[model samples]
Target: MTVVEADGSFVEPFVTKNLYINSGETYSVLVKADQNSSRNYWITTNAIKAHHDFVQAPPPISDRVIVLLNTQNLINGYPHWSGNNRSLSLPHTPYLIALKYNVTEAFDQNPPPDTNDIESYDIYDVSENKNAISSNSIYRIGFNTTVDFILQNANTVKPNHSETHTWHMHGQEFWILGYGSGKFDKVHDTKSYNLINPIMRNTVPLYPYGWTALRFRADNPGVWLFHCHIEFHFYMGMGIVFEAGLEKVGTLPTSIMGCGKTKDMIRP
Candidate 1:
């Protein structure tokens, strides 16, 4: 995906690599459990986020939010599925976290502190209703030459007697920024991702009712699909496409990248 500036001009440095955080910047953090589960995930360090919790007084500044993998665990909930036989005492570490910063939370205008010591929530209180504090996994991909893209998943969901839902994206890979419930907070604006890297494929499991966030560049000019890959969920409209770079791709005859077959595009 290509990263463009506010005025439609392309940002070179940002589009060079999947740089998770911009250079010379740091964000304060706090940890909290998902809504019901005592399993604590990092919320915000200084302020309040709708679906996440924090251990420190997060500075009032706004930027892309990240989950602290060091502080997540499964302490208070029963095993999601007994047949699977993963340790009940173990917290199912998350692969990706859904982000809820843009259009949901309000952004702050101050620069953040360089170094901050944040506390974590009680491990014992981690509950099932809460966002699962993910012991996150990180993957690095190189775009082309100058920039590299980093990505991960942070949220998960286990509905009562339901199959685990894996959220995946098509044509573009994104960074698992953060996870939360309710509408996304409209604060943290979209982060610029470097696209001068290799292409990537990704999938993240979501906690039922939990939302995850992704950071990627809109460099690829295609109608990309972001949805639950459960197939059933997708047919039911759990899928939404991110339309980027459509203008440059000019309107080809409906025969190309269209929903209809050749016969449909042409009238008899």
Candidate 2:
């Protein structure tokens, strides 16, 4: 069977019953159904290091977000992975990345601190803010631009409890730069980024209360979905979209044109 890397690259074919799939990661494997002809085989999945109960000291203010002054110095000339704000609410609406046809806009190359710089707080701290998660939240990038995203897992609502998330992206495969425990230290972590021969994959796993970094160029012209691979988490709103190169996206096919308010635009 062949395994797909985070950057959409193919790995040498191999075989294994035990597969590790992260929250947002997707895999395409080939299986030969050459088992016993009389009996059916059972397929199953289990989570390793699924539970955590270790309490960690709060992160220092300075460590909440680690900004990269020279993104160009990085392997792909993209921003580094900064941490995320530990919030449960749906951060924004779906389809926020859908761009109007023929619209051209320049997005800032500088890494934004919205997700990276925000500190994780106890869920109780902001429980009263009904709209803590903004519906208008969106991240836009220029076409063919390389981007680096750092996914950080923090303690869940339960004390001493952290969970694993499979981060997956649509439309493009990214290189798994690196993974580390605790908060992401730019200086220390950047030293370990795999610039050469890194596995290309669409989905990567993040250790509990740890961090994983990835990089990819947004060459595909469309609004792509990037989100946690876990179904329950996705249902609970753990995903976002990347709108890239809208001006280059010429037109929508009639098959995808009719829906909601656009029903009138459907072709016969």
Candidate 3:
């Protein structure tokens, strides 16, 4: 069961205990302790299969291309998941946020491309290598710039198999403009966009073989992560970072700056 405003102004009305909250979907349901306090209650979750498979193939793997600013200059490409190319590994040092006093490197002040102008494609078509996993690419933007992002899902290596990805933005809530199946026709889809009363959420799900478009302002300062909430997919490199508003960001806590270049700096 998902909770909405009392007047049902924003989202559609729905009530059910056994709800399938898709990836990129958020729910806030109020639960009252109406039962006995001493009794134990169990809430369970199980994975449901949308299609049957006769033979299980190995998990898909591929290399990721991380773009710093513009799509023209590709920064780096590394192995995304467990494969012969490069097995995925956790970074020893984490760059959570940059300190205002310590940061010296300047980021691009340009805004992201308009979503209406971008083309949407399936995973297979986008990757062109049949590898579902990709690199943790980042799209840097300036402060207060409006960004429209389109999340498109594609078919898996196994034919007729596609999965849902629940994308979550770290710093800001975005308006979910629209969702649709098949190739996302920008012209037709834009007509259906909900300009008013669209659902504003931090997480939104991209349906299997479908697309979801969202609009948000890059007002928050810092390097914010935007990734799929699914653990395995996240491990497989289904994520990206949005480095925004570096020009106005403040210093981060000294304790959290123990790693990276800040490690050598004297703590205050």
> Could you give candidate 1's per-residue lDDT for residues 47-70 as a string of tens digits?
223422322221222233332111
Answer with 2 or 3, whichever has the higher lDDT.
3
TM-score ranking from best to worst?
Answer: 3, 2, 1
TM-score of 2: 0.57
Clashes of 3: 7
Clashing pairs in 3: 23-166, 23-205, 24-166, 24-204, 24-205, 64-135, 100-251
lDDT of 1: 0.34
Q: What is candidate 2's lDDT per residue for 10-91, written digit by digit as tens?
A: 7666777678887777777776788888998887887766534432221112122222110101113321111233222232
lDDT of each: 0.34, 0.54, 0.55
- Tens digit per residue, CA lDDT, model 3, 97-150: 332543433222233232322243333332344332223234567677767776
> Per-candidate RMSD vs. true structure?
22.6, 14.9, 15.1
Rank the candidate models, highest lDDT first. 3, 2, 1
Local error of candidate 2 at 77, Å?
Answer: 41
